[model samples]
Target: MKLSEGVEAAIHCAALLAGLAPGKTLPAAALADYHGVSASYLVKHLNRLVAAGMLASVPGPHGGYRLGRPATRISLLDIVLAVEGPEPAFRCGEIRQRGPGALEPEAYRKPCGINVAMLRAEQAWRGALRAARLADVIAGYEAEADPRALAFGCAFLERHQRPGSPLSNPE
Candidate 1:
């Protein structure tokens, strides 16, 4: 199934945050800039993440966004759900019972084979995503990333990160 652009953005954004120093935060604009997405549009998805309890918004001049919990506790499915909601990607409209060659009402009582297969596919997809946490994504990224590039990214984040923010100092 094709996921929305927002789901991609949210996953990337969460991965970025997962790589940050504990309690450090990145503004939505910075995240958008890093990913080459529209900041305004990305903010809508960011808000969804916040509402999902996956991320927290810090309010103030130095305020931005930070993970609400450990990256290991936040799965790819969490990010997907935050941006796409809990609806299954493949919706069954019961078209088998609506066409000119409609099946009998008794047939409608049971889900069609196509619908069952789609549902199983969706379940498998969700299971895969649920097994993948943001930390796992970041770990894979770090494993394959160039040392110089990783250093450069760390430097860039440090340079852009806000100082003295409460988020930067966990209680």
Candidate 2:
């Protein structure tokens, strides 16, 4: 199934947040710049993440955004849901009940086989996403990404990470 572009941006933003020092945060504009997306577009997704409790939005001059919880606790499914909502990619309209030679309403009481299969596949896909934590993604990135890519990410975080107060709650 095709997911929205926002999902990619949201996942990348989460991974970047995982790299920040404890209590550090990054502004939306900086995140957009790093991801090569518009700040307005990124903010919409960021707001959704905050609403989903996947991200924490801090206020004030030294404030920005940070993880709502540990990276280990946040799954890719969480990010996907935050950006794309919880609806499955496929929806069955029960076309079997429509058109010519359609059976009586009670005759087609059994769920559509095609719908059942699609839902089953969607469940499997969601299960895989649910099993994948943001921490795992970051670990894999650090381990498998190109050296220059790693260096650039590190440099960007070093340069743009805002210093949130030690006592401030990320939420």
Strongest candidate by TM-score: 2
Instruction: Give candidate 1's TM-score.
Output: 0.91
Q: Pick the candidate with the highest lDDT.
A: 2
TM-score of each model, in listed order: 0.91, 0.95
* Worst ten in a row by lDDT for model 2: 162-171
Candidate 2 TM-score over all chains jointly? 0.95
What value of lDDT does candidate 1 attain over all alpha carbons?
Answer: 0.83
lDDT of each residue in 57-169, candidate 2, tens digit only: 88888788988888989999999998999888999988888999798899998889999999999999899999999999999989999999999999999999888866654
What Cα-based lDDT does every candidate model obtain? Answer: 0.83, 0.90
In candidate 1, where is summed lDDT lowest over 10 consecutive residues? Answer: 162-171
Tell how far residue 103 is off in model 2, in angstroms. 2.1
Name the runs in model 2 displaced over 4 angstroms.
168-171
